[model samples]
Target: MSFPAELSAAAQAVEARLAAAIQALPDSRVRAAMAHGIHGGKGLRGYLVLESAALHDVPREAALNAAAAIEAMHAYSLVHDDLPAMDDDDLRRGRPTAHIAFDEATAILAGDALQALAFELCAQPEQPQAAALTLKLAQAAGAAGMVLGQALDIAAETAATPLSLQQITALQNGKTGALFNWACTAGPLMADADPAPLAAYAKALGLAFQITDDILDTEGNAETAGKRLQKDAEAGKATFVSLLGLEAARARAQDLITEACDALAPYGKKAESLRSAARFVISRDK
Candidate 1:
């Protein structure tokens, strides 16, 4: 299948599963908001889960629930990230953000509920590796991972000086790379196979992904980006683009994409779509 097709397939599967899960919750404004939160985006994290699982010959059914789990967590993060106390954004996916569309209180509740549901899906996987998967999910989403990254980002805004390259790298690893790592490695974890190669791949891919995001923020159309852009520059925040210049940042992202593909050596041709996905990361408009 073409890379776009595969991504669509992954997104479709994950969305269906997520919809079903949200439908099971008791009806309320928060439940509606939860549905709203999971409504859109590229579904790259969920795609990673499905593709990695396919590489390991893990059954899709076994991994589909896990795929949905990560997407739910990602959605929750975005919802909270758009809150007034966070990025203070009023738009997401080219629409009113969760907090703006729903009441702030409802958005908060929806985010909280989505987060809880992510753990539930991971922990209740029909596969035998439920405990390990659950632990990994918590580690990625908890303070030591994504939350830690978000905290550092918030702190960076108030620091006397802008974040250095190394500091920003660390922050991106937590804020963005953590989930990418989990997504890329979940297949191997499910198969009880070694996750080292995928881990390496994800490390490079995550950084490249963030670097491209930095690039997009610099020159992307806000309408195309479906959210605010250039906020970093507006806030005087340091980014890969700010530190390295656009040409150098783009070069660095290309280098990392190559690194990401190289790390998939063990899977040989089986990883073609994954490689394509890496390439797509830098090329995406939004």
Candidate 2:
């Protein structure tokens, strides 16, 4: 299958796994909100997990679990990120935000539950690499990783001066790059192989992904983006496009994509899917 087709297949498998797990929970408003939170995403991170697993010859079942875990974690982040205290947006994936779909309290609980579920999936007894994956996941999603980036972002909003380009880049490394790091390294981690190559690739891919997001926010239609656009500009926040002109930002993203693909050299032709994924990151409109 081609890259997009493979990505879609991976997404479908991961979503199914997520839905089944959520379905097993007792019916409640929180459960409903959790379901809503995980629905309708691109599942890019999950695809990366599966792809990396394939590259390392990890078992399909274990890869699916890992993929589902990351997707759940990502969904939880988005759910909370849309809260009134955070980014304060409504639309997500062209639908109402979880807080709007349910209530603020339910959304918060749902996010918490989803986060817990992520670890649960990672630590399942059947997986041989469960312990290592769980430990790394905690580190990646905790204060040292995604949360740290978020805290930095919130701090930047009230700082005396705008964040410098370097500062924002550091913030994004945690906020966005951490999970990408985990996803890309998962296969190697599961297979007990060196993860350096994929980790390097993920670093570049994550930065490119965020730069493209900044570009989209600057020039994309809100409808096409499935969320608010120009939010950074409206809030007077600095971004890649704000720091670098549009042409420059686009060029930078392309350069990062190239770097990401170059990092895949160890796998040679076997990594074309990843190369395509790197290209897709910069080309996507939403």
Candidate 3:
């Protein structure tokens, strides 16, 4: 199958797993909001989990939960990020944001539930490397990583001066790169192998992804992006594009994609999907 097809298949499998998990919860507005929050994403992070798992020869059954867990965590982040006090986004995944679809309270509760569920899924009794994976995830998602990046981002908005390119890179590394690192390394952790190569790949991929995102915010169509675009520019915030300029930002993203692909050399041709994914990262409009 083609890379896109494989990615879609992986997404469907992860989505099914997430839906089943959510369905088991007690019925409430929060439950409904949780479902809404997880719907319609590209599931790229989950795809990374499954693909890296494949590279490590881990069984799909063993890895599916991890993939689902990452997607759930990612969804939760988006739900909360779209809250009134955060990015204040009104649309997500081509539909109303969770806070808009449900009430703000329900959205907050749903995000909280999803994040808790992510840890539960990763630390399931029968899961391989359950304790290790859970610990790593906690570190990746907590104050040292994603949250720290978020705090930096929020602080940047009010700073007297725009952030430097170096500062933005550091912020995105924590906010975006941390989860990608976890997803890529989860397979190796499960198989008790070295995660260095995929970790390196993820670092480059994550930065490239953010650069492309910044580029899209400047040049992409809001209708196609399925959310508000140019918000950073409108807010007068510094971004990769604002710092590097459009052509330079695009070129830098391409270089990072190459670096990401090069990091996959140990897996040889078996890693073609990941290579394709790297290329797709910069090419995607959304």
Candidate 4:
């Protein structure tokens, strides 16, 4: 199948699984909030999870659940990220953000509930190891990691002097790459594959994904991006593009993509989907 076709198929499968999970929620408001956050997004993280699992020959049914879990976590993060205490944006996916669409308290509760649901889905009967992997994801997304990065990001915006490139990269790795890494690495965990190499590949590809995002925000249109454009610079946030300039940042992203592909060498043809997904990271318009 072609890349776009494959991505669409994966997206559909993940969406179905996510919808089912959302329907099973006990509270109507929480379910509505979760669906609003998840139902119409780009599904990039879901695509990544599915592609990574496919790379290891995981069954489509199994991959769908994992993809759904990953996307649930991603949606939760975005909902929280747009809360008044975080990025404070009023728009996402070309619509009012969760906090704006609902109340701030509802949005916050939605984010928290979705996070718990992600782990709960992972722990479901079909995949016992998913429970352990979910713990890993929590560590990556929680206060010591993504949350810490976000805090630092807000601080950088308030600081008189800009953060160093190294510090900025660290923040990007935590805030953005950590979840991508989990999405990729979780595949191997679910498949009972040896995880060392997969973990390394995930780390490299995750950073590459963030670097490319930084580059895109500088060159992309707000309409295509589904959010405000140039807000990073306006907010005085540190980014690879801001630190290294577009050309150098693009080069760095390419280098990381190369490293990510190289890390998958041992998997041979099994890794092709992941390789293509990595290339897509830099090639995407939105």
Q: What is the TM-score of each candidate against the true structure?
A: 0.98, 0.98, 0.99, 0.93
Instruction: Please give the RMSD of candidate 2 to the true structure.
Output: 0.9
Q: In model 1, what is the error at residue 143, expressed in angstroms?
A: 0.7
Residue 282 local lDDT, model 2: 93
The clash number for model 1 is 0
Residue-level lDDT of model 1, residues 1-286, one tens digit each, is 7777778877988999998999999889999999999987799999999989999998878788989999999999999999999999998999999989989999999999999999989888376499999899999999999999999999988889999999999999999999999999999999999999999999999999999999999999999989999899988899999999999999999999999999999999999989999999999889
Query: What lDDT score belongs to each candidate, Candidate 1 first?
Result: 0.93, 0.93, 0.94, 0.80
The C-alpha RMSD of each candidate to the native structure, in angstroms, is 0.9, 0.9, 0.7, 1.7
Model 4 lDDT, residue 114, Cα = 84
Worst 10 residues of 2 by lDDT: 1-10
Cα error of candidate 1 at position 79, Å = 0.5
Candidate 3: the clashing residue pairs are none
Off by over 4 Å in 1: none
Q: Which is the better candidate, 1 or 4, if ranked by TM-score?
A: 1
Model 1, residue 277: C-alpha shift (Å)? 0.4
